[model samples]
Target: MSNRNIKVVRVTKDDYDQVCAITPPGQIYSGTDYLPDYFHMLLDMSNVEAYAAVVDGKFASFFLSFVVDNGRTVVTRAGRTNKEYAGMGLQDVMRRNTIKDRKYDKMAATSGAHVKAILDQIKSGKREKILMMEFRSYITSGDQLKSILNTIGNTTPSSAKPIDAIELGDILTNQQVSCHLFPESRVIVDWVPYRLIKSNAFLIKTIRTTVIGSNLENGTRILTFGNYFNTTAGLVCNIEVYGCIGETLAEHLYLHLRELISHEISGKVIIRCFYRQETKSNFITKLMNRFGLDITEIWGTGLVCTETTPEIYFR
Candidate 1:
């Protein structure tokens, strides 16, 4: 009993208005740019394949599909022409993405040698689990959301050492970052071995992290920031920090970083927070409770976000 058209397909430039209907305003508020640009970039990358739920032949709802970091990871985002799709009791739109997991994996595997090579590299890595992070808005009030979130904590692996053991560091480099030609910049480390690009296009800036202490504690803070590079996507910028801290510090750092990057870069910034290892710590649950970050249950990774875009380091 779906109203309006629901068709999932590769988006075209012409579909801007329809897609915008579901997306937030142009203001870089919340995580709007992630999807709109994601659509265009998908088309540009040609590595992206979209699927929509077309009802009545109109684009009622759509999900953006892309394999990033050379095919080592698959990311999909869904939105509807009307906001109803994301409302309570009607979260089916969010659920639709889970159905295509295997399909996308197979697609990435069969697409090109680059993906194959990336897979081989991942297979060789010592890490044993996949990590998935989802940054989304909090639909319900804090109390209710807390109840729901506590039930679903950050994604973690079943058979790995806990998050407490891993060391965390914030990396920032003042070195001149290199920018590859458009599109080529999207080349990832995993794709390097397969000849995807001459080499990893992501410009690595040698960043220095001020080692605060060796102990993994909850109150420590690490702040990282650097310049952006022109890639297939818009001017890419990154600000990241990793330390054993609570959600308050994470949110505080995220907020300050977002303001910092936004003031500096007129364009949109996609900020990403990466945790080193899995943590079943109540700290993760507390972070989820405070911030809107969601643990994408699909891949077992701890990912949080702010209105910031960190340079994508494929390696």
Candidate 2:
């Protein structure tokens, strides 16, 4: 329990179970669910570097970072501290130590306190530039879903089909193009490996649909992924939409989402958009407002700090 007894060590395959055992259950930090199996996968990844704060050989906190954009960036995937170890600053210690070994050009993260912590490091003279502040929009209601649907007007729905890595990669590329061209576009940083996608996809219970004319003559596709769980607040549906479709099509896609998952929507439907720059926040905020869905902003920040600037690429 003493501060001097705590030590930060590189996490190994042997530490997987202990790490998960100490991870706080449900919404561990910034709405991120603690997935033990996923944690195991991260531990096994050659590109991922993980660290843990241990006291007397017991896990207290953990942090994970992995190469993204083909080694151009290192992203902090998740960090959590055991409630029993609260107030010890274990999370900060793990983050500091893990990042000190960074071999990549840029570092990125997408959690509230963690983002602020990274910013503090930059402010303290770490070579870094604030790329953007990221935010998410949460919507929960059938009425609002309907309103958004009506606002978007008629949209042709494409057949439901599973998106392969190739198609997903193309969609992400288009997303990057949209981000560069549109002043109001929101960009999300995703660096997940192809091998891990299949396993994680199962937990999301996703619904995929295409919106005609949202992009070019080929149109755009929307992938809405989430799950419903019973909580004290009631049965809540948390959904995340991916694709670079414009605001109108984004709303229309949500309508199709409601149709596909109506049985799962119970007390509330919490829809979350990927992390977007502050400049593009208005596009999503306005859409959610028009639909009467309450909005909560999940704040995150990104910094570009590489010795040699690397070419930007979507991951």
Give me candidate 1's TM-score against the actual structure. Answer: 0.36
Per-candidate TM-score against the hidden true structure: 0.36, 0.56
How would you encode candidate 1's per-residue C-alpha lDDT over 51-123 as one tens digit per residue? 5555566555655544444444444333344455444322244334433344322111111212343345346
| Candidate 1 regions with alpha-carbon error over 4 angstroms | 2-5, 26-32, 37-39, 68-73, 77-81, 85-129, 132-238, 241-315
Error of 2 at 287 (Å): 3.5
lDDT of 2 by residue, 258-291 (tens): 5535554445555444433434666766766655
Output the number of the lDDT-best candidate. 2
RMSD of each: 15.7, 7.7
Task: Give me candidate 2's TM-score against the actual structure.
Answer: 0.56
Report lDDT (Cα) of residue 241, candidate 1: 28
Task: State the C-alpha lDDT per candidate.
Answer: 0.34, 0.50
